[model samples]
Target chain A: MSALIDLFSVAAIGAGLFFFFAGTVGLLRFPDSLTRLHALSKADNLGLGLVVLGLIPRAENPLAALKLLVVWALVLLSGASTAQLIGRALRRGRK
Target chain B: MSVLPALDVGLALLVVGVAAWTIAARNLFASVVGYVAYGLLLALVWVRLYAPDVALTEAAVGGGVTGVLLVTAGKRLDALASAEVGVPPGRALKILAGALAALVAGALAWVVLTLPSPAPSLAPAAAEAAAGPGAGLGNPITAVLISYRSFDTMLEKVVLILAVLGVWSVGADAAWGAAPAPLRKVRPDGAMILLAQFLAPVGLLIGVHIFWVGADAPGGAFQGGALLAAMGMVAMMARLAEPPRIDSRKLRLALVAGPAVFLIVGVAGLALADNLFAYPQNFAKPLILFIEAFMVLSIAVALPMLVCGPPNGSPK
Candidate 1:
């Protein structure tokens, strides 16, 4: 059971890596500013979230895991709000 | 070799990719968002590298507050520029800069992987020293911040107060009633308003909890205060509370309260204890806790007010 859990954790991490790569590709290939923002928003949030989840099981204690969770939650909150603010500003500029 | 190191390498790569996109993006607004994303990813990297304290600080100050500031500034600047005008770096210049950045990244990675571990981190020693009579905390960081390094923390608070004063002196006040062009009046009964009301109190509770737990865990005054500030911002957005007038005397008092209390406490310590800002060994926890609580409240208000920008009741 422990081996299986470890394998699953490794796979989750790999999945995170995949999302991060997708974000990079999207960032480079997207034609417009807003679309690239969309790519970054989805990719980085999911990528980091998955990675943190993968690490939680390996944490030494519950407090350590809680700390990891806090970091992830803050990131998500800040990332989304910032994206909205920037996107709104861009739209306003065009008008 | 463990697979953990391989995962660390991958995380480092992600950090690099995010940094590249942040600086290279054609749109300045997109670039600011990219920077926020970069900071968040970098915090994760810190976690993977076993620096949880640094990670927490990076997540709050770097990813959270800095992101808010940049986006607010970007919005103010957007009105001055045309989006159609792209500011792409010259091709040769880009290549040269890319090579230089890559070289620096490689050097850093090499150092990180090759550096030998130092014997005995100062944490254990600090923890041992803090375990003296009347010390109530088990967490080394908290002990250091409040007891051993109390002076540093006091000075840090002073810096924060000075920052608030500087911001105020520069006429940093949010433009009242300058909602975005698409701003619609959020009904007081709307889901968003209701949600803000529910979350604001809960956020306040969590902030207090985190502040209290700092003595034993990964939370601290800065993180707690920033969270409270975030709640305050939500309240402002939902119009649950009206923005204070730029010249309001009450606003000025709250802004200065944190530092004023900190100074008073420090002076009392000098008279009662052996040194300035020194809490009687038995009173360290309560003193630190009291100061942090007030600091959190002040910071929560001061930061959002700073972002709102200038007192003339205009958005810019």
Candidate 2:
């Protein structure tokens, strides 16, 4: 049972890391601000979500796991809102 | 090879790179962003050094509050469009500055390298005090700040008040006692309003939690207060609230409450305890918490006021 959980954790975290790497690449390679923001917001949020999912089982307690989920949720909220704000600023600048 | 050393090396390199970028960035805003990043990275370094209190402080005040303050200043400067953009330093001045920096760096490096093999530390004594007859607090950092170094801590709050007054002193005479300008000149869109509405309450809860836990844990008044200040600033930025008038009695009271209560307690100590700043036995923790509660209030108020700058025009 423990071995299975470890394997699942490793696979999830590895996948999360790949997404993070892809997000960074997109941030650097995207042609414009809006597109880069899109890449970053979407990929990094998913990356973080996956990372949190993987770490939940390894948490020392249920509260710690909940805390991990809370952190991921906070990040998602802030990231999405910040992206919107940045996009609005970009649009205003263009105008 | 152990991964820890590699991680340390990488962090060190990253910190230096970010510091260099902060100094080298051509755009003021970009430099400010780099500076905030550097502060956060430095907080990580503090954490690695096993100083979670300092880490929280560095992340909150150094990175978060300072970032907002600089960005506001930059915006004001851009609005002014004064000739103060002025001249860049000459090559001779730059070289002189570089030489001075190098000299200071060399001196610091030499001092660090020549330190005693077994570094001198007061940790054992502090721990004894914390765990025994002293404050009996679980966190030595809190004990030291609130009890052992109470005078210094109280004075630090006084210094914050002084700093706020200093910021206020530069305002126009007509604007005296008036509220500072709104933090955001631009009307924030719906998304920012939503973000502030949602985040502020959550941040406030976390801030208070951090402060409340400081008595026995890694969090403390400064960290919590800084977080509170950031949340307040966010609300102001979203146009949910405005900076209070400087002359408001309630506002002034809140600002000075921390240092005042701390001083009163210190004075009372002369009668109640042996030393001027000593807390009486058996009641140290409660007294410390009482003082800390006020200190937290003062810090939370003072920081945002400092960021808001001196009063702009007359009151609305």
Q: Estimate TM-scores for all models.
A: 0.67, 0.96
Runs of candidate 1 exceeding 4 Å displacement = A1-95, B82-129, B132-134, B171-198, B314-316
Best by DockQ: 2
Model 2 clashing residue pairs (backbone): none
lDDT of 2 by residue, A1-95 (tens): 99999999999999899899999999999999999998898676999999999999999999999989989988998999999999989998999
Docking class of 2: high
Q: Write the per-residue lDDT of candidate 2 for residues B20-103, one digit (tens) a residue.
A: 999989898999999999999999999999999999999998899999989988888888885247788899999999999999
Pairs that collide, model 1: B173-B309, B173-B310, B174-B308
Worst 10 residues of 2 chain B by lDDT: B127-136
Best candidate, TM-score: 2
Off by over 4 Å in 2: B117-120
The residue-level lDDT of candidate 2 at B179 comes to 92
True-vs-predicted CA distance for residue B194, candidate 1, Å? 5.9
